[model samples]
Target: MNIIACIKQVPDTNEVRIDQKTGTLIREGVPSIINPDDKNALEEALRLKDKYEDAKVTVLTMGPPQAEVALKEALAMGADEAILLSDRAFAGADTWATSTTLAGAIKRLGNFDIIFCGRQAIDGDTAQVGPQIAERLDLPQITYVEDLEIDGNTAIAHRAVEDGHYIVKTEMPVVLTAIGELNEPRYPSIKGIYEAFREKEIKVWSLDDIIVDTSQIGLKGSPTQVKRSFTPATKSAGEMLEGSTQDKVRDLIVRLKERQII
Candidate 1:
């Protein structure tokens, strides 16, 4: 089985600045890390690889040149190979554009038995890319997966539901978007680190090499654009109550009513 884990390096800090003029994320000098949820997905892939010794685990990511750091991290965690899709034309891409680019990369990489993704990215919590890629690839997808079991040519997983969960099964080549609650991620050992450092990965790809249409990439092809983003101003502190419990409740209710919060 060939398992491909789609990973991303996102800004570690939440203090993202929005460029008001362009309505885009200001990524300059933002320290990035591997998406936390993707780590869980990678762990699941590694576990499957361990269980089935013949299985091959590969890590794939799309970002600027710096994103190779995330792929190396995945390598250190036991991925067999790594691919980085980086291109100037892919800049300012929204989820749709991203899914398109990733699908292209996957197609270029040939066949795969399974694909894994994080439940959501901290930077862009739209949670649409995984399902979108599945649609592009014409495969069944289980999102928000908290548990997965692989058996031969099929797989079963517990997908998150509104109030509970749904246990679903699909044939091989299914896409699974894993949540952090699925399993505990492992750290890279000395051997892993050494191997990763020595492994020469496939270099980044641009639109030219990939033969992607410039119009269908980057901000131009992105259907959804951030109209506005800003941090809300802080509000005043709450009032202090000095009375019995009942009195405090009454006062709180009155204050809530006065403030039109109820």
Candidate 2:
């Protein structure tokens, strides 16, 4: 089985700050980490590889050169290979363009039986790329998958839904978006880390390496535009009412009425 796990290097939200004047993220000093959910996806892929003797897990990402760090981390977690899709033409791509680029890269990587991805990246939280990639590839996709198993060429996935979870079965050559509850990600071992940095060569691909239409990549291809972005105003502390129970209740009601929250 050839499994491809798509990952992303995202800003550590804990250290991210907004530029008040520019209404943009202050990324200059922020550290990047693998998208938390993507780690779960990678873990699932690694587990599948462990279970299937012939399985090969390849971790792929599209970002700046620094994203190589994310791919290396995957290798250290026991992925068989890593691929970096980097190019100036891929800059400022929205979900649509990003998925398009990824789909092209997957095509160039040859036949893949399964593609895994996180439900969403923490920074964007849009949860669109995985489904969009499936659309581009014209493959079946299962999102919010908390558990998955394979038999023969069929994939059985337990997908999370609002009410509960439901099982979905799809054939080979499918995309799955994993939720964090799927599995606990394994930490990199000493030997694995050493091999990642010293023995493995992460394959890098530029725009020219993959088949893509010039009009469907990067900022020029994105249809959605951010008109403005700003941090929400800090909320004020709530008032504390002091009185008899009945008196306090009455006062709260009056306040609610006054604020039109009744």
For model 2, residues 130-174, the per-residue Cα lDDT tens digits are 999999999999999998999999999999999889999999899
Error of 1 at 260 (Å): 5.6
Stretches of model 2 off by over 4 angstroms after superposition? 238-262
- TM-score per candidate, in order? 0.89, 0.91
Which digits, one per residue and each the tens of the lDDT, describe model 1 over residues 164-246? 99999999889999998899999998898888988556567777556455676788999885667765677999779989999
TM-score of 2: 0.91
Q: Flag regions of model 1 displaced more than 4 Å.
A: 20-22, 200-202, 211-214, 239-247, 250-254, 257-262
lDDT of each: 0.87, 0.94
